[model samples]
Target: MFLASSAKPIDDNLKNFVDEIEAQSPSLSVLAARQFRYSLRQTPVELNIKEPRQFNVLEEFIIRAAIEFQPPPTEDELASVLGLDSVFIKTTTATLRSLQTLSATSPITVTPEGRSFYEKGSVPQPPYPIQINAITDPLSDKITFQSESLNETMINLPDLADFITIDKTIADIASLPLEEIQKSIQASGLALHIPEEGKIVASCKVVASTQKIWRKISLFVIFDALEDKLSIQIRNGKQILESASNWLEVLHSESRISLQALCKLSTEAINFEREAILKQKNTEIEARIEKIRKEALETSTKANNEIDKSKVLGEAVQLRNGQISLAFSEVLNSAKSQILIYSPWVNQAVVNEKFITLLQKLANRGVWILFGHGIARRQEDEDKPVPPEVEKKIRAIKTPDGLPSVQFFWLGDSHVKEVIVDKEIYLCGSHNWLSYRGDYLPRGESVYKVTIPHQVQEAYEFLANRFQNHAQKLWENALENRDFQMAVESLCVRGALGMEDIALKEIQNNNWLELLPVWLNVALQGLKSKNLPGDSESFKTALSLLSQVSIEETFIEQLQQGWRKVIGAIAINNPETALNLLSDEVWAQFIRLKIVQESDSPNDFILYRI
Candidate 1:
């Protein structure tokens, strides 16, 4: 006798309402009872109705209202069509709106869904037949259900909504197991109240359960969607259970619900949430990478600059007065065996104390030291003697042989000033070693270390030979006239007349008196041995000077005495034999007494003596 049937389980309250109606109508026909039962199962029923009416007013109103109003009727118009007062119409429409049977904003037309509900002869198919879709908001602890039943009922279950804790994309939700999802929803405190039914369903079935770890915390959850409700289960690992559910009865009566809309909304929200999260993470990562790149580039640039500076230093070095001391120290310290210094003027005040100390140390180590200064008269208009302190320091230098370790010389004509170290390095420019005082000098000066090998060697050789010649000149100038006269007489006694003739001529001509002693020493040396100190430039120079002098009568007796010895030695065919015949030392006395006569040139002979 039933007009319609469904496999869906009916709520107890709905079944009880039908039972009460059947019990109250004892005279109701079987057909009427069957139709009423079917109606109750598929469509919402008015619990206040005590008996069946000839026409179902609610269904008729919905159908007729939809047909009459293209742009649905106003409340007044709708009331007129139904023959009801405006207040009654308003109240009925509100209920219809709540069920989604009518538009909430209106001309009072029936909803498309509402039309579908009543088209099946007041015995609509089971509502919300499609699967339920749900979304969760973890931060707000809310869950939103997208289902035809939920939308149709306009049920705002704040308690159940509050349970959703996380907002996720459709993909994320789909990928997550239903059990874990249920646990998350339950943890948010899911609960729903059915105000019309005066009932509350706080528990949900977990069709599936799952455990997952997120951010280092274990999460156990259950997720399921039953015919009448969408449910979730949440647990903190093994304890602290929580659950939530959205019941179908709370949203729509057994007869009316829609699943398509719910799925669409849920999918949209999920995609939006996922995109937003991924974009944020990507931006943060990119920013961090940019910062690191900048720092690395800055560091690399700094390193390159330092390397370039080092290269510059290796190629060449420039030094001024302030930096010259350090440069000098490096030059001196690098010396292994030789040090040569040349300065135009010599004075204690001009030389650095540290330089003097270093020189002394080098001298003690047997490193050859040559210190040159301009000739006293050639240095300036006024002659300057080597400072007393400088001489004392020089004299203090000790060597392995107990001989003077440092040789001092005068650069008579050359004005070059430079320092040479071990023939490997050299410094040249305007830096005056003997006169520079970095603090007192107003003029800027520079000294540079020579890097070219040939240049260093060339400079070293020039200075060395010049210093050697100057040293020789100094030693020769220290000899006295008697020293020279004795040297000449020694040669005469040896009957080396050829050499004596050369010496006599040197003494008479070119005022070679200063070098007479050196010449006589060489001649004496020749008489003592078969070979002289070989023919040196110095000996050749002496001979050249003698060639330029004219013989003078002032030395006739001395010359004749020397000539007689030479003649005797040669006649005997043995100079040593003749010299032995003259009784070795006697001729030196005559030559000293006779040859030491007054010179015609007072200027040349003023200090001369025999």
Candidate 2:
């Protein structure tokens, strides 16, 4: 489950071996040595010294050992592994010894006549003489390993095109042209190594060549993008591109001289194959989904524009040129069993005429009808009169028992306008369908209707939902009005009867202390007396005259009681005058009673405080 259980131990051991190697010399790994050679190549040409791989036997052993086993190597194992055929080793040693001696002997020399030659009797080319050296100089000794020997001894493998097929990984790959261009090498056969079978799988072509300075550099190249054949590399910025019209041009003129280039091309090919398959699949899926979404949206728009009776009221009614119109009376007249109306508006006169007529007609046909009517007005019209003419017309409609079959019921009136008929026809809009607000309107108003399937449970659900939405709005408005009334009455009662501190606290919290109108209104209730030093007696006179002008005997009695307290409280310092002004009931409250301690019996009861 965890990599540390096995992988960590192997890595730790590997690190220990690498650390020991590093302590001696950091340039112990083949990759580091190769990089060293690369760095040396990048140096300015003036300091160009031949590479020195052959000079140190241990260095040669570490490099080959690193390439084979990588780490945790034993000394004997590495040496045995690196020690190739002695014949080859001896030949390389001899060449190195000769070059070392030539470099030490002179600054410049041409031939045996001018300088001693190992060949002893041979003629030499001019530049060749300047280039030739004994195998003794450390720098020249490094050269023979890279020169004639490496090139001459390296074996060239035959192309195995006949035995190749596309790798199993890309059998599903159709044609991705860009991938073909990008996938030059992987899209087709490059090469593979099958060491167990003692074969290479035609993925790479290896070749050897000697440089002008007699150093050797191997080049590996892969053919990529058959339509636009390119030389691809795995670990380099450099490449050689050539167009091959056919396979013959590749076999003949396409120079496949470097084994390294083949590795680079194979890497690029593998990466391209994987990425292309995934990208293609994603592109196809996204294209299909986008096509579906676009088609669905187009279908929805078409449906929303459709017109006909099969659609509730049809899309024609939804047009926004600016009027919502409906005519659902036809639907009501056709009802078979029952009619139910759920209009939020219960306008008095209109309900008396059209609504009552509809309900009475439906009831006469033995169809049950339920109508809700009490959407309250701004203030209570609980005792308000109905026009006699509308009332007479409504009375004309009756059931078999000769009683009014149409009834109105409502919870409250806030802001709702709706209509339902026979549970099969429904209408709701900004305007009441009856002559309701229409009676007071200056011009045109808006209305709309929705026909219900009498059989659908959503009919009752639809009305119940409308009631719930408006009920919340009504409840919120009621709470706002209640809070305002409480705040106003709270200041009136408390400021009139409370201590100064309590009144001031209420004033401060009311946030209207700075508004002179509110302060005066709140303070006026606390005046206690009407006639002060500057009194014109206007308010007192108005109260005195109004008290006698009673609209109702009960109201007059309440006013009389209020006036008695108002005058008596002003004469508080004159108890005789207050007593004379008080009525019998008022005198009963002021004729104080004493508080007697319960600790004493009737014989010794004491009046302590009153």
- Model 2, 333-448: lDDT tens digits are 66644444544444465665566667677646534333433333322453333445544554455444233333323433323444454454544435554445444533455443
Residue 585, candidate 1: Cα error in Å is: 36
1-610: candidate 1 lDDT, tens digit per residue: 1122132122232343334433432211111111000000011111110111122676467556665767767888877876878888787667667655677786777676555545543312222212333444332234433322212222222222222222322333445554454454444353222212222222233222222212111111111110111222222223322321223222323423322222122324334433433243234434433443353344346566764664443223456676776777788777655678887767766555775677767655546566767633343443666776777776566443233446564554334457887666777766777765446444687666654465566666656655544433333442344454334333332212123354445355536454343344334333333233333233334333433333543544444343343223232344334333332133343233343233322122222210
What TM-score would each prediction reach against the true structure? 0.27, 0.23
Q: Give candidate 1 misplaced runs (Cα > 4 Å).
A: 1-316, 350-353, 375-383, 438-442, 474-610
- On the 0 to 100 scale, the lDDT of residue 46 in model 2 is 11
Best by lDDT: 1
